[model samples]
Target chain A: MEQDLSAPGILTSQLDQAIGWARKYSIFQYPFVTACCGMEFMSVACSHYDIDRFGAGFPRFSPRQADVLMVVGTISHKIAPVLRRIYDQMAAPKWVVAFGVCTCTGGFYDNYATVQGIDTILPVDLYIPGCPPRPETVLEGLMLLQKKIQAQGRRA
Target chain B: MDLAPILSDIEALCGAPLSARGAGSDTVLTVPPAKARAAVEFLKAKHGFNVLVDLTCVDYQGFGKGTQNVSPAPEGRRFKLVYRLMALDAGTGLIKARLALDSWVDGESVPATIKDLFPAADWLEREVWDMFGVRFADRPDVKRILMYPEFTGHPLRKDYPIKKRQPLIGPADASARERLSPADLRPRIVE
Candidate 1:
């Protein structure tokens, strides 16, 4: 068996190429919106934000059918449990983009009802912070998560 | 106390002590617990506090520890009950009556039930009682709202502990690990 010194770099380059292809492909995502940020997510999906440019055309409704999990609002104590279960149910090679300050860190709801951040419950790849972030910010985070997924040879 | 004579005329009812404060567009009433239902009857049948806008609580024990619960206070007799009502009549205005009660005390006399007049009061009263530990003598279901049923203490009280932990932050050492883990990770399994 010959040990090739450049094989890892080639694999990495191939992985990068695969990620570029994935970024150009449509991504099915489950949006978990609980608060004001959900409105911005709507705006991104609308003509104003125009998410179609990134190849993420329509957001999927069912978790079983989606490749990305987008947490778009506040996760409360009552709701966090459900969110965790949903994250677990998503297929492997899945990516999560925490899409608002409330979802990323509980925002202004400094109380028991709201979870401080989604990371405590689910492993988040990207954290998008804003009381209700601009749709552009959400799209940017989505793009970053796609890049991260490419590095892992996964489709987001 | 006796709104009986005033009931005959709806306009005259507003002139009573209930609406005397008359803050903003909403008329106000301060009623004792015993006559709460009667006041509602008069308002619905005569004057217009008819809509039953909202029934909520105000904890007077100040801000305290535990969960981020504000509406409920642990103080036995220092809680306040607020009832918001509106005139269903398109032309009529809005009204609010705020009643102060100390129903948190186990034996301290709780004001009579408002549920009889507004069956809707049942859910609202239950919510207040569940959150604030206020006793609404006649409210049918006084269980937990906005908190787990097994929740230890009333969070809205001014003395509950406040702890802020950064999300997804793991413990730094073995002590932290032991604190977080259900079993002693240090214990070895000898096969």
Candidate 2:
């Protein structure tokens, strides 16, 4: 069994490709929604914008089942520890997407209450830059994430 | 029914104000420390000023230029408390008799609390206490309303730098090992 594990050939490579392709399609997301961008996320998740085309429409509220962490709004310093804790609780091979300008760069709240950017605490995968990114932009970001997942997947 | 009679009644309780302004039917009065609560109690009982809209504090250390109707304060008297009260009028919903009670207190002195009169003053005073670090003389609880208990300085004070942050944990804390990453929790080190 150990010799077979050590040997990397066509069969294992084909299995890796199959796994990556499967992972790229079906994504269970955990939305860490805090402020206004949550409204846009709801619009994108609901029937109007329809996020189901990307196969990531179903949201897992619990962090354990989710592979993607979509942080949806302003993350204040008061809530930063909680955000960090939630990120830590999610299983490995998890990706974090900063949803708005506030989560991306703290927007206009350059004060005591707001965290300047989320990257200071947790490592971020992609940043969707807007006060609230439009639904079309969100779909684009989702596609970008799928590409990222595909690239990162073959390693497993 | 009129503001004059109400002002006279308030003045009878708390002597004359430091500065008084009459903007329409409302009265904006800046009273002395101890007498303001008496006047508020009287207004609630006698007049129809039942609603305590807000109880807030302002740190005037580097107070900027103001509007035409500005109340002047003495030197070293930095913190000013503003209490807004409203009367529920039948004709105009809830703003028939709006009274703004403004008072100055040094950072060291504790002002007499009107929380006994208005239940809303409990949270409002606590919010002021949390933001400006001003304490009321006879308040019930000493909990911080907006900021956490571990938070040191008041964030809303004029002297407080806008960008200065006192975080509860992580990034800035010395013992930041409490915060864990995905790499930290892995069963084995990845080659």
lDDT of each: 0.61, 0.78
Question: At residue B129, what lDDT does model 1 achieve?
Answer: 64
| Fnat computed for model 1 | 0.03
TM-score of chain A of each: 0.84, 0.91
Measured against the true two-chain complex, the DockQ scores of the candidates, in the order shown, are 0.07, 0.18
- The residue ranges of model 1 lying beyond 4 angstroms of the native Cα positions read A1-16, A154-156, B1-20, B23-26, B46-48, B62-76, B90-110, B162-191
For candidate 1, report its TM-score. Answer: 0.71
lDDT by residue (B69-173, candidate 1, tens digit) is 664434454565677765554553423332221223322445566777777877777676666666666544567766666555556544555443222222212
RMSD of each: 9.3, 6.2
Encode model 1's per-residue lDDT on A78-156: one tens digit a residue: 6766888888788876778778777665666766456766666667777777767777677777676656665555333
Best by lDDT: 2
Best by DockQ: 2
